[model samples]
Target: MSAKIEVIKNKILSENWFVLRNFTYDLTTKDGTTLRHRREVYDRGNGATILLYNREKNSIILTRQFRIATWVNGNENGMLIEACAGLLDNDSPEECIRKEAIEETGYAVGKVEKLYEMYMSPGGVTELIHFFAAEYDEGLRANAGGGVEDEDIDVIEIPFPQAWAMIKTGQIRDGKTVMLMQHALIEGWLSLT
Candidate 1:
């Protein structure tokens, strides 16, 4: 049984550079078919990646910014501490993160160590996040990291231990960012031991 997507309504709230909106939807289950129904309206989303680069001194690179959408989820106002990442227009996850690293943090990430591929919010929206981590040693620094025009970003550097602690204590609120950091810690990928 093929579960069909029955979209009750998809409205356009605001569409200029990107689109924003309030979408309401309901699903009519297929007879005898186990299909995912659109029971509740969905949140807006786009694809993104998280980059974890460990410099030679056991420090990791992170970014700080003001996230309006994050405040609604539970992140305290202003200051989304996240790894280097950005939207993937159509590029593969690996490619997207590599590019984002250079664009956002001016770091040239080497061969990325795949961490996780998952949806940021499976219950409401389709925001797939691809995560990777690499050593941020020599031959990785590029131009300073920052959004081209509109985004205000401040790079933050912290030792690996502190980063892991924050993830465990919920200080790191970005879903994908947290997942990537935790995976790296447990798997012994970013450890000196």
Candidate 2:
């Protein structure tokens, strides 16, 4: 089937960590029938969520920390297991990956391989987080990266094989983290063997 172009109307409902707004699309049939749709979205900045992986030593650097909001409804183990990620923060996905890598894990990435853009939760949020993986040595330790005083994070390094097992057994709960590691396995991106 084919689609046609149409004009739209958008109204802001509220703005916060993410933006929630109402939009109306006006579609006119070739025969002159009019149709409209009102939909709402949560504005999670078109930011990037990156995964900084070290292929050389076959390890993936991740951040583990307690999430307060998540605890209210999330698992009793409110500790979030996630990749090295953050908002785009005005930088390109490439730049965001590099910066977040150092800031969250203290690793200086040599290069980044683009994975894909992801909307963590499109049904409610607008986070178009991009995924990436870089090669580094887990044995090499730089500054211990974490967020500012307001932000809390603890960096953890996991062997590629262990990460793969987690995915295979459904132990990796984080969506983005699971996706990246699974891709690495399927694509042979982490086959040190």
Best by TM-score: 2
| lDDT per model vs. reference | 0.70, 0.75
- Whole-model lDDT for model 2 versus the true structure? 0.75
What is the per-residue lDDT of model 2 for residues 55-106, given as tens digits with 9 covering 90 to 100? 5667777788787766787668787777877788689988987887888888
Model 2, TM vs. native: 0.79
Which regions of candidate 1 are displaced past 4 Å? 1-45, 72-76, 168-170
Residue 45's lDDT within candidate 2 is 74
TM-score of each: 0.77, 0.79
The lDDT of model 1 is: 0.70
